[model samples]
Target: KADAKARSSIMLKAEAVSRYPSPAAPLAYGTAGFRARAELLEGVFYRMGMLAALRSRALGGLAVGLMVTASHNPERDNGVKLIDTDGGMLAVSWEKHASELANAPVEQLNQVIASIVVAEKCDAASVGTVLLGRDTRPHSEKLSAIALEGVGALGAAGRDLGLLSTPQLHHLVRMTNGEKGAGPYVGDTAAWNSEQGYYTMLADAFSALLSSGGDRASCSPLWADAAHGVGAPKLEALLSKTPQLQVAVANTVGTGPLNDGCGAEHVQKARLPPRGYEAPLAGRDRAASLDGDADRIVYHYWTKDGSWRLLDGDKICALFVGFIAEQLDALALEPPISLAAVQTAYANGASGRFVKSLGVPVAMAKTGVKYLHHVALENELSVYFEANGHGTVLFSDRATSALLAAKAEAEGASDEARALAAGRLLLVRQLVNQAIGDALSDLLLVEAILALRGWGAAEWDGLYEDLPSRQSKLPVKDRTAITTTPTEERLTSPLALQSALDSLMAECPHGRCFVRPSGTEDVVRVYAEAATQADADALALRTAQATWELAGGVGEKPTGAAA
Candidate 1:
């Protein structure tokens, strides 16, 4: 009876919304989910809701999450990424199903859903739930409504978390699913499921970390660029609770164009502070930029010589690895805890060598957060980051248990050893977001580390110098022809392409080059690094031209920077 009712409701809702014309171009579920012009995402959003309902039903009603965001993209663009019960990206296997459902013609929509139902063996009678959240994008509200309508049609329950960061939504999904059937604290589950809980948890953790460390007053105030996105107000709320650290926020106007010449992407690409980001911060004061969705962060600061220095993902990983390794060494447990940092080919060679110099192992994974996250899981303590600033720290169960045990044992030790062990362990678990890369969480972690080490951005930047590098995108008739090795450090297709690149690289000091298809865009990304900026740029252009010639490029040969 329940199954029949759900089917009826679903059909009615689908029938009403299904009348909207399908897009001329089929939607492909990319690494970032269905992202495009906001005007074209209504159908995709509706179908994603249905898929989320099915996913919830498949998991026996554990809450799934739907985040409406385009991350670093401009405000005109919008996207949706499904969150699994574990608060991670949707399983790789289901991406195909999502693509099929999203692009299915209206006439065949029901057939597509039926196919998925038969294949996954989802019980229609089972209850389904979806937790929905959106960034501050203008189109988010209408798109969210369309999603909710789809959920209703499926007869699934949903809670609209009015406005939230991507990480906040992930945190809620994990807390909701993890806390199920487990008795809750603070009156009920609602307390933990709200944004209040999210802010409180991070605030409390930050407070604990600050209290456990040396004088916090000596820390310099940070200049933060919120990219005029949702993170600004949320960050303000967060800082209110933990007042030890002061931050001056920029580009926080809600009505402003998101990621418009600002945000992590801008900071990283331009290697400078965002436009309109003057905060009177200079000398020792640090600065950071959060993407439109606040899932990634990149740090920079003005030096005494008046040059802006960037501390990218690679540097962040080094700092984290060094700190964690020091803590573990102090603990000196019987069963050793292995610490490793994960990076992509985009990582600067200097960063890799720096991490190795600290006696920490480094692993290279293909581009994308899911791939990095998976490889990070192999180590007891994994710190993964992309050069573009998307990443997080993961602590295995063994590492968490060992840390707790060490902290307990330290309670009876000398004051110096006890403070080192307990404080470091607690701070590690509290400072890093295990679920995903969170700009706010990472920002706090960076601040805490700077304060503890008594080092300014200059000192940290002095750890290593990034080799001159250039990245260019070449449009090809078929980007799929450009296949790569597992680590994306070498090209496996376009026979002899790697050889040509190697020859060019051999001519330049410290030169390296690689080509891979962009997962999120329709271009072949060519990366080259060398001893000098001019060589790097020239090598990148040559490599891109070679790839274009080999991979069926669409137009005339690319030249100069466009190459």
Candidate 2:
């Protein structure tokens, strides 16, 4: 009976499948997430349902929740994500499972079913529950229907949380855990983040702050570029949830959601020429844009000359850390929180050192937020950063209490640990002053410090004092230039890359240089950071030129003067 329903659902969705047919799987998992050709709706749906089922079982039979739509991926591309039982991201280890299921034969798939049944210790007659949510893509509607076939086939009750952000789906899973008569079951929520739930947290934090003092009139209106993905509706939901904040959204309808016009990936201010203003690749002040799913953010602030200063991942991390620190000081806290921040390799070293000088502990990880997030989990970190503007702060109540107690018991004068402990008393006070990683969380730290101590972004900028730098990417005609294999291979001759890096580091405004083959495309990513902008540019260009030569690809030289 269930199989019949499943077949009916797929058959009903046949027209959509035919229309989409799944784009040539032109995407691979990038640093932040996976992206694929939008036409491949069937493959995407297959992966989605399998992940949903796997996540469900991982959390003790809790309904697995899925958000179906690629956030910020290119228009020709789409994606699927799994929210875990605790409303956190699914373990990266599970990506392999998704791949396995995606490629399994019908017979092999049935074997997987038998294995899961035995593993879950369930009888053939038992059923589970799974919830699915999707965004506005035309293919998404079809993918959802086909995915539903798989969900129903699994004997899992299916519920719909339509047009939700990744964060909202996460929240739904969390809320369901506490709902009345929701379950006699394991009671765990979904197993991943929701695009909508993040906005909810932001809204919650903002509402809490506003309610603490100001009335409606004193509040400022906020605007966003919806990127024609799921960001608009989710942002709307967030504002609706927090009535105190006046929110106006734009560029939502028919926007491409990638590094297209009017998104964090492109478009700065209304002033920077309507088009061809691509240098900074994001807008200036008063507006912002989110990718398809809204997990990451980029700033749109302007220079004094009315030129745009698109705040990249490094700037955002610096802004948040500085802002949170000031908030801690205002409450007369003596660094009680013992702040520890983690950033990825791609992040600017200036921010890392700046954070450390403030007596906060900092760790450097590889180039992914997942690594940063893991460090936070391992250290119970108060904050973490990625050069790409992906970040979050630790907010566990249990962790806060421990820090407070540590600070409270420190003697008037004691060892470093004791002093560190005493310093921690301010963490709770700071957290209360500023909600944990609130999306409404602005770059207030610089202004706050200026107002309080006569300091500025330049002052923070002095910590590691970035050397002049330049960076560019060159594409290769063949995948052979980089490795096409799933396994890691040398993107270019290591010795050649090292020689270029050594040359750059030996020069004034000394810095490092490296070459990376893009995980999602056949391009070589050349990065260099130095004290003098000229040195940075030269180093980046040289390394990139070397990479291009190695790959047998022609390339253009770096452009524009160092700011």
Candidate 3:
């Protein structure tokens, strides 16, 4: 009888599915997932809803996630991405299957879904759940509603978690599917699985970690720019959970569209403060920006010399990995757990060198959190951060076991130092959202680390000098024409373009440059770094010029003083 209900559900959904027609152009799941103008995404969302439910059924009724957000994209745009049972982005191998399902013709949709079920060995008749969350976009609510219908079509439950950040949804998915933590951050704990529980967990972890590190009183006030999206409300709710951090949030609401002139991408790429931050940040006045869905973050402030400075993912990783390594060294456990740092090709040359100096191996991956997270998981404990501020620390079962055992022995021997060291790492794991990179969670983390070190924003920047670097997007007739090697640090196709780009990069002292298609948008991204700002800008411009001329660029050439 249950199987009959499930079979009929798919047929019932076919009628509703016909309402949303696929766009004239096909959609491909990119580094994140399927994204496009809001008008073109309804069909994708409904299909993803079914896919999410099927994924859950395949994994034995474990809940999956569907987040209706376009991280860092403009309000005119929206997106939907599936979260796997592990709370990470949908598995890479299955991305192609999702693409196939999304692009299937409406008439043949059920057949395609059946094909995926058979290939993936999914029990389509099994009941499952999909947790749905949406951003602040006007269309997000309606899109999520359509997705819910698709979930019902599969005879699966859809728990709608309205208006949540990207990472929040990922957290709930992992927790609902039974991810466990050592102490209070438990998956089976029903409270920790709710949106409010999310805030409470982050707040409690921050409070404990800060109090443990001594003098939380001296902590400096930090303000987070909310990017006029769901992060503002989430940050406010976080404040309700704990009052320890002397911080304030701004850009809580905006009359204009979301991320119009604010966000981590704007701050890091455009080199300007987000809107509503008219007052210049100086001295120890630390500030951070969150993208649309609040997954990425970048810290910034104005230097005394009136120069603006930004601390991005590379800096975040350098600070975090160095601190974690120091804690491990202090513990001096006989079964010392291994740790490393993983970065994409976009990381600064100096940042990698600094992490290597701290005695942690730095591994390179392609430009995506999924790639970096998989590579970092190889070690017992690994830190992965993209240059754009999308990252988090991953703790494997091996690391957790070692730390717990070491702490037990230390306690037995009354070794206060080792016990505290081991405890600190555990507390950190509790504080961070291990599911994915979270801007809100990361804000608490950086602040707590600074308090422990007695270091201010300027002092953190003083740890390493960034070689001047520039990142820009060159418009092209077809971004797909460009391809790269595995690392994405070097281009492989268009031999003529690659030849010209290499020559241009070699001309600058300490120059490094790469060009590749942006997985999220319709442009070719170019990056260059050099010993000085001028050289970096010039090299970037030259390489973009090579791509423009060789790879069929659009519009007028990118004119700049460097050019």
What would the per-residue lDDT of candidate 1 be over residues 342-458, giving only the tens digit for each residue?
A: 999999998999999989999999998988998998998899999999998888778776777777777756546755765676666756676789998888888877777778888
Regions of model 2 farther than 4 Å from truth = 1-33, 112-126, 178-204, 210-223, 241-247, 255-259, 267-285, 326-336, 403-470, 476-493, 550-563
Query: In candidate 1, which residue ranges exceed 4 Å CA deviation?
Result: 1-16, 179-192, 278-284, 413-419
Which digits, one per residue and each the tens of the lDDT, describe model 2 over residues 365-427? Answer: 655555666667655335775555556665444445554555565543343454443343332
Considering every candidate listed, which one attains the maximal TM-score? 3
TM-score of 1: 0.94
Lowest summed lDDT window (length 10), candidate 3: 179-188
Across 411-432, the per-residue lDDT of candidate 3 in tens digits comes to: 9999988888888898788778
lDDT of each: 0.82, 0.52, 0.84
- Model 1's C-alpha root-mean-square deviation from the true structure amounts to 2.8
Residue 220, candidate 1: how far off, in angstroms? 0.7
Q: Regarding TM-score, does 1 or 2 come out ahead?
A: 1
What's the TM-score of each model vs. the native? Answer: 0.94, 0.73, 0.94
Colliding pairs, model 3: none
Candidate 1 clashes between residue pairs 3 or more apart in a chain or in different chains: none
